[model samples]
Target: MAFNRTRWAALAATVVLAACGGGGGDIVPSPRVPFTSLVSFGDSLSDVGTYKVGTVAAAGGGKFTVNSASARIWTELLASDIKVPASCPAQTGLLPNVPGFTGAPVTNTPACTNYAQGSARVSNVFAPSSATLQAAPFNQVNIGLTAVPVTQQIAAHLAKTGGSFNGSELVTVMAGGNDTFMNINGVSAAAGGGAAAAGAAVAAGWPTATQQAVAAGGAAAVNAAATAAVTAMGQAGAELAGLVKTQILAKGAKYVVVVNLPDVSQTPFALAADAQTRALVNQMVTTFNSQLAAGLAGTATTVVQVDVYARGRDQTANPSRYGLSNVTTPACSTTSPANPLQGSSLACTTASTIPGDTSGFLYADSVHPTPLGHQLQNQFVKEQLAAAGWY
Candidate 1:
């Protein structure tokens, strides 16, 4: 039989085209962008060490491992990719809370880069004014009593650089989680305690007004409160997104990555609630994410919105896909099921975690993610940044 060289060449070409057709074209090369400095603004999820000096000594919303000598959040992981130091702007002049000691206010050289703080919101409804900030005890550091809102964080960055960007910076914004929860709780409290009492509770730096309201109401009343709370949170979230555009994008920021809130109801704290209550919290999260996405539809800045809400749900639903074994349980131990968020010993290592497997758990406490979970979040950010060619 004669060897047909022409037919063999044609067959090889056909096989090559066929292989390229099956999802090979989907691999679009990332168009590289020159992005230098990295600026982040958000709450505890993105905070580096704004609360390292706070007087609180609890987990979840209270001061925990994200401060002091145990600071390892997503920002640090992301910054390491660029060989940049992940020191908090507040650490320079901030004074750490010393047990049984009182002294004059301490100041350090301004860093003006990482301005994230735990318990920070898009708008500090509780401490709305500087007068209120000075009077309240929100922070024990140099930033003062007010929880620096995402807006304030951006403002501080702008103030440091004379209110302008050089178009060579990569800005990261991950706020609205605290805003969502605070609005829901505030509205829930207002449903039963009246607006004045709810306002008073927040002013006093107490967050139990919502639980007090829930206790006073029946199932129907509670459901109604939840609905109202979701609506309130959605409104606030939309405004926060708008601020990101007006404040960051409008200020000449070229690259921006904004992360939406995840399903907080899936957290250990919300998981301890009644099924109906958990459903309401999840709904509030969805509504806020939707509103935020809608608000940032056509911004001039190269804005990339990461849907963390969906990612969290998927990780819980399919743990093994993300190499996770326990999605519903907190890595840290707790004494109270009624208040799961108030857990203890967030320091997760090979020894501290139960079953001696900290990598299996999705949560470190009632609300925050484990160190492994934080790494997963950093992976998500990396994927988005690479997709947008800003890595």
Candidate 2:
């Protein structure tokens, strides 16, 4: 007989619920514990709308997906599934110095708690389109995200809530993609030129290197950059784990779900990269996930790990199974004048998408997901949460 995925899922969920002491006779089991609110931290993948201002707001685009009233990212979906308050940006702002672009100053929303921001890194303060990179050479256009690192995001939350969780919020963390991107950019810069250029890249939070390595240039420089980038990613993962343990858990957080990095090497952005760059990205992701797992090894009771990497690999390998039609092509039109960031999904909307229907596409742009992709991610998270009896 043909396998029924829905039945299989239901059976698995029942089994998990039974193992967690739910009633075996019940067709649908209740959650083990109720979650009061959802507190999120990370980059664009989890961002609800930290940069929904000025031109981006005018174009009805934000959250790094095909922006619309119904376009909810994974975090929002998770909030709804768990029956918690709707997620909203904890902070919002965009101050771009680019011509023809109007931006709003940074503002804090005390009532909201979704802290994830587009282009945010795990610990690094500098990120793409960040206010830190708005000077001369980088000249990031569109709205400049604050790009507050995840470490500080937690700190800000603690400061806001009197430095401790109430043990009822469902905390989710997903970051480090931007850190990998910075490292890759450093490698590219090192491969292209002398110590001065490489040093500048490193100064932008790319990676640190010994004086000799920076002065080496050539293949030596490339190797040094790659090594540094990989090492830094591992450190980032460890840092995130550390934050969860010492900051969140120690402060009274009970249900924390840590999402590992997805295999970005399979994204359209990486698909456009050379073989060497793609390989480097894969290595960086591997190193980060390994370190994160190692750091969180003994915290199984309070922490649940979501393997987005494995899920992403499976989805890319078998898109049809996930109802994805085009995993390789972006659904957004890169040349549309309506999108100030050009191809960035942060500004993509229904008006700027490709001619055909894009609801089945996996990606909205080169790096960011479409609404369908976000839904797949939400489903994956829900399954994990259910298995852990947290939803």
- By lDDT, the best candidate is 2
Q: Estimate each model's TM-score.
A: 0.73, 0.89
> How many backbone clashes does every candidate have?
1, 0
Q: Which stretches of candidate 1 lie over 4 Å from their true place?
A: 1-31, 54-71, 85-87, 91-109, 125-146, 187-197, 200-224, 335-355
lDDT by residue (tens digit), candidate 1, 262-365: 88777765665567656777787788888889999996348988878778878878888887888777665444432222243222222334445666677765
Tell me the lDDT of candidate 1: 0.56
Candidate 1 Cα deviation (angstroms), residue 229: 1.5
For residues 115-181, write the lDDT of model 2, one tens digit per residue.
9888788887767657776665555443567889898899999999999999999999888888776
Task: State the TM-score for model 2.
Answer: 0.89
**Model 2 regions more than 4 Å off:** 1-30, 135-142, 203-212
- C-alpha local distance difference test of each model: 0.56, 0.75
Q: What's the CA RMSD for each of the models?
A: 15.9, 9.3
